[model samples]
Target: MWLLRPPGVYRPQPDTWLLVQALHDAGIPRGARVLDMCTGTGALAIAAAGVGAGHVTALDVSLRATLATRFNARVRGLPVRVERRDALTFRAARQFDVILANPPYVPSPQGDLPRSGPSRAWDAARDGRALLDPLCVNASGMLSSGGMLLIVHSAVCGVAPTVDLLHKVGLKAAVVARRTVPFGPVMNRRIPFLEEQGLITAGQRDEELVVIRGDRRDDQP
Candidate 1:
């Protein structure tokens, strides 16, 4: 898909594709209400719309990203609502049937997130769960009964924690898909830091990206 991304908006990469594939596999119900959190270029939102989602909402904190998504969806003539909001605090009157996220999971040396710039696309705190942890906790509340949340991130961030968090939040969570790819420029540059932090092996050059699914069972009240 051709998307119009400004300078600071994140370009879709392997992790993005992995989430898209997982979304496809999950199978969108016709007219499902879908939410794509941290939507950089609106790729997942567009995918949801293409798959027959009646209403798709894309959220990003970056103005550039929101504009790009708006333009991209408009060009495609897809019904997508773009909002500039932080995924951590975004609220909706009605819950969503599906939630998709490809948040910043790359472990960063800094303990805090960047206020602005391209690093916002991939830099999380030292543990790389800055966004992932919160998402695991809050996603269930955003999802309707029987809704599903699909999130993708590197295994370096500890996939088990994510699953456990989702489980603790009363959702059935598991890793549904995984793909190992060579480290990109960002990861490659952080090899030293990751090695020092013991997030990766001394010689490891590839990272495994996993798509985790958290399902809110129909039995839930």
Candidate 2:
């Protein structure tokens, strides 16, 4: 798409396209209320608007990202309300019919998440669950009855934990999509640390990304 992201905004990558494709395949309910968490350039938010959502709320903790998202949405003539807020701490007025997220999932050498810099775009705690854990748990409540949530993360972050967490919250959750990709530069640099953490084996250069889908069917287990 024609996205205009300034420096410091996270660009949509393969994981993003996969989630978009999943969104398309699943189809958005007409007049659906949608939320795009950790929205970088508003790619998914614009996509939802383009698909006829009643409302699209896109949010990011980074000011630059929120600005880029607004600019891109405006340039595309899509209706997306952009906000500068952390997804983990956002308190929406109401639950949404659909929620999309492509949060940071890359393992970093840092003991804690990066406070600032481009690293914030992809760095999580050592195990890469800093955001994923909260997201999976909090998203269950953020979703309305019969609503759906789709989030993408690397397998190194533990997809099983995500599914289990969502399930514990009474959302029917499972891995809906997965793709094996060669490690990018960030991942490549962390191979040794990842191996040391037993997340990967030595000489491993490939990683699998998975999208977890959760449905709040009236909180039925």
Candidate 3:
């Protein structure tokens, strides 16, 4: 799909496509409400709108991203509520039928998430769970009785932790999709630190991107 990306906004890469595919597999019931968290270029949001989400809310911390999402939705003739809100911090007005996120999971050398720059799109702290952890902990709180959450990230951040954390919170989480892709520029550059973090070995070059599904037990179909 064609998308408009402003300077410093994240370009849709393989991870984005994986999320889109997983969303497709999940299926959207007509009039189902959807939320796209950390919507970068609004690709997922637009697609959700296209798939018949009754109301789609796209939230991002970047103005450029929000504008890109709104613009894409407008050009596509879809109704999407684009907001410059930090998705992680907002209390949803109501639980959603489905929630999607493509958050920063790349392990960065820095101890803190970036304050600016393109790194903001893919940089989490050293452990790489800066965003993932919170998202898992809070997911059950914002989902409807039978809602589901889909998130994409690299295995380098430890997929088991994601599932384990979600399980702790009473959500049935599992890996549903996996793809091994050559390391992109960012991951290639972080190889040394990743090795130091014991996330990769000396000769590791391929990283597996995975889509994890978390659904309320009572709502599983």
Candidate 4:
């Protein structure tokens, strides 16, 4: 499916490549149940299906996004289930073997940015950790035993805090992959803080991609 460059919606970020590559490298088995949260254009979901995920459920808060996902899936002839629902309120009737998400980790400003497609995708509430926190906290309930959750985000948005939250919820989080890219408008002030905290280093600084893995446990928090 073609990705429409709509106003106020966040377009696909470069970090999405990181997720696709990592998942491809990880070798998800054919017919494995997978869930893609905040699936913007259904890129990751489509990739997963192409790479042999048995069933893929792509969820997003925006109806436009869901439509895009559906269109894309049809174009590729990949059978993906697209759902329009807020990630926070989405309740899975069954657990999945793999859960993937690329949420809006860029903290939103008090005033809204220009109503662009990319803006809508990137802006998040409260330092960009709002969505990440809830996802980690609720992951155990949504993932089956021994299932895994793969998430990608920037280092500037408090990666440590995200790791801590995941651990607190009984998930063993780790940085599976990372890459630096040219920082853009959505990444303005946060870069300095990330550098100060050693999350990003000097010389050619840019966005960092982090992949966190959540281990399954019956006694999860």
**Backbone clashes under 3 angstroms, per model:** 0, 0, 0, 15
TM-score of 3: 0.97
lDDT of 4 by residue, 130-214 (tens): 7788888888788887788888998767778878888787787777888878888756566665455454566545667787777
Q: How well does candidate 2 match the true structure, expressed as C-alpha RMSD? A: 1.3
Q: Write the per-residue lDDT of candidate 3 for residues 37-96, one digit (tens) a residue.
A: 999999999888888899999999999999998999999889899999875587787899
Across 1-221, the per-residue lDDT of candidate 1 in tens digits comes to: 88998898999999999999999999979999999999999999999999999999999999999999999999999999999999877777789999999999999999999888899899999999999999889888889999999999999999999999999999999999999999999999999999999999989999999999999999876
Clashing pairs in 3: none
Candidate 3 regions exceeding 4 Å error are 219-221
For each candidate in turn, the TM-score is: 0.98, 0.97, 0.97, 0.85
TM-score, candidate 1, is 0.98
TM-score of predicted structure 4? 0.85
- Candidate 2's C-alpha runs over 4 A off are 219-221
User: What is the C-alpha lDDT profile of model 2 across 2-43, one tens digit per residue?
Assistant: 788888888888899989988887788999999999999889
